[model samples]
Target: MTDKNPFSRRQFLAATSGVMGAAKLYGQGAAGEATPAAKLALQGGPKAVQGGLPQLVRWGQPERERMNALIDQTNLFYWKGPQTTLLIDRFRQTCPLEHVMTCSSGTAALHIAVAAAGIEPGDEVITSPISDIGTVIGVIYQQAVPVFADLGRNTYNLDPEDVARRITPKTKAIIAVHLAGNPCDMHALKTLADQHNLVLIEDCAQAWGAKFRDKPIGTVGHIGCFSLQAAKHVTSGEGGVVASNDPRFGPLLQRFGDKGMDRLAKGGLFEVFATNYRMSEPQAGFAAAQLTRVEGIAEKRSRLGNLLNDKIASTPGIEPHQVHPDDRSTYWFLMFRVRPESFKCERAEFVKALVAEGVPASAGYIPVPLYGNPVFQKHGFFAGRWPLKEQGLTTMDYAQVACPEAEAILKTGVRVTIHEGMGEAYVLSLATAVRKVATHYAH
Candidate 1:
């Protein structure tokens, strides 16, 4: 009954036992004997995922308490504001970076990192080709070039080998984007950055609370960027945080997000040119509250995600999302690959079959590589003209750019929705749904 240990051990057991009880009903098929999913639901049999997913309760009392505290505050500014201060304090407890800055959006956090890292016009930054345009928008706006590298077939994160091959004399930094909350192979990437004397920026927008090799993901790189957009693991509606333990880039984060004026300097001529991307105190407070829930949310999703992978591992032609044993992927949404040759169905049909069996599954991620977009193909940045290429500062041509593996990934990847505290029974049934559909559709 202590404050720190509020729940009794018996109560904890009772709660978990209920979830375990349901799991027994949805286990994999027994050898030879008929299982509940022996007949495929796509063929007029019962659906596997009985009892739809539990409704999500993303925010409530914790968020409201923080909001109430803000209501009595005198200002909404972020400079030394208590809410912002508390948010940063709470964040550091999790990520533990010496210098941190909360900003307007994840894109802003990265732009600050790139600008702080001193990327200049025509400087090349190697990154994944199959990510949200936000991953490169900062580099482009800084007048730097984003060298799109191929990715791993199963991991769906940047391929370190391809990254090393893309490195050139102009490479000033490498932005390692942890796509779908899966940690990139940071060890190889960090080695490449150090050997080449280039900065390594970890784009961790989707990977809140994820770890690489037992160390928090953002810590291994020089700078780490995260998103708190509504879709992320934890959110403040629209906010971001950038952090770095490196003294070289740590001190510059604040000014880059605050109009380039060093608040620590009190009153001095603005030396750095930047925009106002500061996050307000209200958003900061809300984000601080969300931080309290992140580790719990991450753990639940990680466990459930791995369980789904375990449940579906033996299905023919299916490649479960590949996560390193030492790394923790928060699984914003579990993305797996389906071998085309082993299936008698197209990707769309395979996804439809899973849906019919009551699994929330969909084919592919993005439709094409970042360079495949018309804007890149047309060399149309900055009102339909890219100055870096026009001024002869760069010789890059996106129209000729290609990453075959990345292109194939978007064609074969299947996204399965997972959530915080998703019951194990439901996860088991989701696996059953996949097994049923995959078995029926295999050649």
Candidate 2:
């Protein structure tokens, strides 16, 4: 052995072989030594991370240029405006759907989808229980019953089996929300929808660059809805886009968003009754600029999120969020669940420990399922009574709805926000913090 090389090739091979042999001592340790218990940060141990993670800037020169150009042109209307056309073209380029229409907000986009699906009074639309109210607002406004379905314990997306069981003769559509940018099992959902002859709508509000088995999420369903709210991956202050490939529904989306007037048609006759949900030129300009940065933003976040998951996969008492191997999740938030049996502490205590260890974490998602909300339970929309149920057209009752899995997940889950600018080292430190806290509390 020389001072520079440190060891000969034969010596190096022998040492590595011995290390492999030590790994065979299962339950003892990875290298033939008893593992020491991790010290809790709450008990005066050093924190894993020393400082805050990087902050993401929502606007920059690109957004400024787009807004400036729009202002110079002085065209604020979306109809036949340059900004609107550019936004639609850019959205199609990214999403690659046959037809796309920009709207005022995510709720408006969903309402357009509901109208295009031909949802009428008393119709039933099935969707995940753990989602924003925007997902079901359109269904209620259309006088359709929003049937809440249970979610997968690991993925937090809609469970296809539960959705299948919830399907009834009155079921007209299924809205699959890509919760936290994790793609739902599109294939299974599509199969169920086809068998029932129901329309499948993909709510991709949280999933800008997510893919399901190599296919973009929104394209897998009949109509796809997206959001451009300030908090989403792409922002235009507040806006949305609806896309579709089905010939029957594609044209209808455009008309529904423009107050039932076919702007492309030679003459306007008001063919369908609808409200104006147009996206203004300024919103389109900003959204178009933001859209250009989505690919890079999603790629970086996915890499960091995956690295964090890999680091914590072997941590005792910690269960990382389950994602399909073939799918690409754009990880809006990195989530994990605690195996309560393996830990002495509850979820609240576990999260408190993590935060003390310099990791950004929250207790869980929404406090309750959507059906448990006061509006649904009291049938309070449109003067305090559900007209369909009152008229005997539907017997759906929100108070009777149950989603035990979603409730349980809400009780045990924890999440950390993932941002495009978060570096790999920061993510790894987050993982270290999680493992330290979890191991310290392990029973």
Candidate 3:
């Protein structure tokens, strides 16, 4: 939270002062006529976001110093390793989990969590159809079925009711992905899990400082998985952490992440099989430094994304990304939708206009839901064959899996960049860019 900002005094002023003036000017023109700000930059008019955006400085001297300290360590192993210890401690300040294991990547963290949760062959893990493949990689690896569930229409997260419907006797766990750093409806999901006696794993890779109803995301579920990928809120170049308060799974995290070795018992006998997914001390130290910036970055991004949502709330064809007012979404990115019949232009044209106006916007998020991928469609998870299906242990068929709402969301969604480097005025201008394009093309 006390991380240093890289913006110089003048750069700060340039981002703040100039954009503030632009927002004030956006309201009117001579004799209250439609201002030039209302004109689309696509029409050769003035761009809303002038001077572009200030550069973001993700790491600096603090990260450097941590790496320097890391080099002095005699061994780089994560077991009782100092850097890993500090990294976990810093992470605990925010998440407060009793048992944590740092691993090579978010994918590894998820696999470790799944194995620790005892998700075995033929078991089903219900999760949203609109997330990174890493979210389900572990389930597939464990020879479990990843049952695709429909998402909340607005939240881009798993709809608890839909998840409930998809649950079967074979259901072993529910993986709630906090998509776009927005927390899922954990209360309802947790209730369902309890009623069904299933494990709940929170995929928190995208949610660094996100909170659901004021509770940190990872604390609610049985196991929490986080990413430290280069693009995430924090980074150790590439790494992850899996943790839990549930004693059933907590003590097993280390074993699962470290080739099924029980370090506590000095790893003599192997009851389960696992792969090597350890993190080096250098990465742990770097991540520990990155943790310091989490709060500051999350708070700033939250403010900017919320500002953009508010400014564009009334745009006729645009539906602002939905985030609960009580939840802190940190908004890794804002995803809103455009109702096709409400506008005079196609989604591609609309996106072009916004980008021309200097809004960092794109036509949609993912091209298709995760289930629609070639591998899923063809049932080729492992070397052009799925052993689970071949053995008939599960009668699952991915080609028939349908999550229409997720499909619709991806079709209509527009992804807008929102980061901590951005100032309020820049976000306000982004709002103006959306309004200008939507209003000009209003049918």
TM-scores, each model vs. reference: 0.92, 0.91, 0.92
TM-score of 1: 0.92
| Cα RMSD for predicted model 1 | 7.3
Clashing pairs in 1: none
Note the residue pairs that clash in candidate 3. 1-292
Q: Which regions of candidate 2 are displaced past 4 Å?
A: 1-38
Tens-digit lDDT string for candidate 2 (90-168): 8887788988889999889999999998999999999988888999998998899999899887788998999999999
**C-alpha-based local distance difference test score of model 3:** 0.85
Q: Over the stretch 1-65, how does candidate 3's per-residue lDDT look in tens digits?
A: 21112223443343322232233333332123243336688888888777676678999998999
Q: Could you tell me how far off, in angstroms, the CA of residue 296 lies in candidate 3 after the best superposition?
A: 0.6
